[model samples]
Target: MSSPRQQHWENVYSTRQADEVSWFQDDPTLSLDLIARSGISANAPIIDIGGGASVLIDRLLDAGHSALTVLDISHVGLTVAQKRLGDHAGRVTWIAQDVTAWHPPQDAFALWHDRAVFHFLVEAADRAAYVRALDRGLRPGGFVILAPFSLTGPERCSGLLVRRYSAAMLQAELGADYALVNQQPQTHLTPAGNRQDFIWCLFRKSAT
Candidate 1:
C-alpha cells in the first residue's frame, strides 16, 4: 500500500499531462544553470530530489552527466519521465521513495538538487528528516542547489499548504555545516500564465 504522500503525487501524475502541471517548466534553465555553477564534473554523482516528471534529468543526460539519480515519491511520475526518455531512460537511476523516509547511502552524492520540493515540508519534523537525509547523502565538499518558494510566494499549492523561505531562512535550516554561496530570486510563469515566486540558493558543504 502506498503512503498518503506517495498516493497523492501518484494520482497527480497519473491524471495530468506532465507539461500541463503547475510546476512544469519546458527549459528548467535556472536548475541547469545552478548545476553548472556547482563546478562538479560531468561524471560526478548527482541526485535530484522530487525529480518526478521534470525534464531536468533529460537536460543533465544530454550534457553528458553519467551518474544521475532521480528520486520521486510517485512511481507514476517516474514512469512518465521514463516514457519520455525511452532508450535514454536506462542511463539514469530512478528511485521511488519519499524524501524524508528514504535512506541514502552515506556520502553518496557529489551534488544534491531540489526544486520546489523542500517547501512542501510544512512540519518541523519532516524538515528535519529531510535535512538528515541531505547530510547523509551529500559528500563533504559537495554542492546543494535548492529552489523553494520564496517568502512572497503562494501559501498553498496543489491543495496543500507550503512553508515559504528566504535565503537566510534556508541557510538557517541547513545550519552552519553548509555555507551559502549564491542566491537568486525567480518569477516563474506557470503553464496557465500565473506567476510563482521562487528563491534559488546554492550552498557548499564543509570539506571537513
Candidate 2:
C-alpha cells in the first residue's frame, strides 16, 4: 500500500481544482490578516511550505510582497499553480521537494506559512524532522504561521488520520525556540458543509 499521507493528499487534489479544495477560499482573508498584523517588513522574504495548489501565491503577490517562494512535494500541484498565475508566476520562486529533506539557503526567509500540513506528521520522528526544517529555513526573528487541526477538531482529513493539537500542546511540540505570539480558533467548512475547528498559531523566532 502507498504511504497514507501521500495517497491521501494526492487523491484529494486529484479530484479537485484548486478552488475545490476544502481549504480553498476566494481570498484567504484570515491569512492575509495575520501577515499584516505580524509587523514584519513589507519586503520581507515569505515562503509558503506545502503550498501546492492553493490560492496563497495569488494573494501574496497582490499584496506587493515580492520575495515569495512556494514549496511542495507535488509536481502536478505546482504545475497547476504555475498555469493559474501565467506570466506573473515567473516572479515567484518554486521548489518541488519534501520539506524535511530540502535544505533552504542560509537565513532564507523572514516568514513561513503552513496550512493543513503539520497535522499530517503523525509520527514523532516525522514531526521532529519538520521542526528541524523550520530551524534551517527561517531567518532570525522570522515569523511562522500555522493552521492545524485543534484538539477538539475532526480526527480525519482527506480520509487519513491527523495529529491534532491545542495551542499549548503545539507550542510544546515545536519547542522553546519559538514563542507563540498569537492564536485564534477557526472553523473551516468541508465539502460536505460540515465545520472543522482548527487552531491558527503565529510564532516568532526567539532571539537566543
Candidate 3:
C-alpha cells in the first residue's frame, strides 16, 4: 500500500494535465534566470527536489547541462516527465521518494533547487531531515535556491496547509554557515488565474 503522502500526489498527477495544474509555467523563466546567474558550470551536477514533471529539466538539458537529477514523491509525475522526454529522459537521474526520508549521496550536487515544495513541510522533524539531506548532498560552497511561500502568501496551497516564511526565518533555518547571495519577491499567477506570493532565496554554503 502506498503512503497517504504518496497517494495524494499520485492522484493529483494522474488527474491533472501539466497545463491544468496551478503551478504550471510554460517556461520557468525566472527560475532559469536565477540558475543562469548562479555562476556554476554547465557540467555542474544539479538536482531539482520535487521536480515532478516540471519542464525545468528539459530546459536545463537544452542549456547543455550534463548532470541533472530530479526527485519527487509521485512516481506518476516522474513517469509523465520521462514519457515527455522520450529517449532523452535517460540522461536524467530520477528518484521517486519522499524528500524528508530520502538519503542524499554525499557531496553530490553543486546546486540544489526547489520550488513550490518546502512550504508543505510543516513539521519540525521533517524539516530537520530535509536540512540533513541538503547538507549531505551539497558540496561546500554550493548554491541552494529555494522558492517558498512568503509571509504574505496564502496560508494554504493545493488544499493543504503551508508554512510561510520571512527572509529572516528562512535564513535562520539555513543557519549561519550559509551566506545570503540574493532574494527576489515573486507574485506568481497560477494557471488557474489565482495569485500567490513567493520569495526566492539564493544562498551559498560556506566552503568550510
Candidate 4:
C-alpha cells in the first residue's frame, strides 16, 4: 500500500535528479552540526530516515562514523546514492521500507535523524505510530533529530500535500517521554529555485 507521500517521493526520484529535490544540499551542514554537537559518541550507530539521495550520509561516512544506515521508500533514490558513493556503498546499509511499517533491530541505532519525513504522516494514527516506533527503537538515552516543514513553510512537495508543524507542536506529538533538547530553523533550496523554511528539532529519550 503506497502512501500518497510515498507515491509522490517515488515519482520524484524516478523522474528527478538529486539536484532537483528541494532538500538537496552539497552539504547538509546544519543537520550534521546538530548531530555532532549532541555530545553523542562519534562511533555510535546512526540511522537516517527518509535519507534518500541526501548527501548527509556521504558526509557522515567521511566524518569517520562507520555504523550508518539510510532508509528510504524510493528504490531509484537509493540507486542514485549507491552509484554516487561507488565503492563506499559497502560501508553503509540500505533498507527499502516504508518507515511506518519497519521495525528497528534489537539494540539498534543510537541516533535517528529524519528530515522532512514526519510531516507527511497527515494522520494522527500514523504520526503516533512513527513516534511510538522511535521511542521503542532508540536505545535508552539515545537521540532523535527531525526536521519538518514549519507552520509557515510550503504546504506541498513534489505535487503532494504536506502537513506543517511548529517545534512545540511536534514535541507534543512525540509525547512527554521524549524531551525536546534543541530547535532551529533551516532554509531549504528547492530544485525549482525556491527557498522553503523548516524547523529542525532534537530530542533525547528519557529513562522514564
The CA lDDT of each predicted structure is 0.95, 0.85, 0.92, 0.86
Instruction: Give me the candidate number with maximum TM-score.
Output: 1
Q: Pick the candidate with the highest lDDT.
A: 1
Residue-pair clashes per prediction, in order, are: 0, 0, 0, 0
Question: If both were scored by TM-score, which would come out higher, candidate 1 or candidate 4?
Answer: 1
User: Candidate 2, residues 1-208: lDDT per residue as tens digits?
Assistant: 4454556666667787777666675768778888887887768999998899888889889889899999987777888899999999999999977776677887789999998889887889888888888888898888999999998888987767899988898899888889999999999886568788889999998765
**How well does candidate 2 match the true structure in TM-score terms?**
0.93
Model 1: residue 205 alpha-carbon error in angstroms: 0.5
Residue 132 alpha-carbon offset, candidate 2, angstroms: 0.5
lDDT digits (tens) for residues 58-115 of candidate 3? 9999999999999999999999899999999999999999998889999999999999
Over 43-116, each residue of candidate 1 has an lDDT whose tens digit, in order, gives: 99999999999999999999999999999999999999999999999999999999999889999999999998
TM-score of each: 0.99, 0.93, 0.98, 0.94
Query: Runs in model 4 with CA error above 4 Å?
Result: 1-5
Q: What tens digits encode model 4's per-residue C-alpha lDDT throughout 16-49?
A: 7898787788878888988987787778999999
Query: Model 4: how large is the Cα RMSD against the reference?
Result: 1.5
Task: Report the poorest 10 consecutive residues by lDDT, candidate 4.
Answer: 1-10
lDDT of 3 at 149: 95
Write down the lDDT that model 4 would get.
0.86
Model 1, residue pairs in steric clash: none
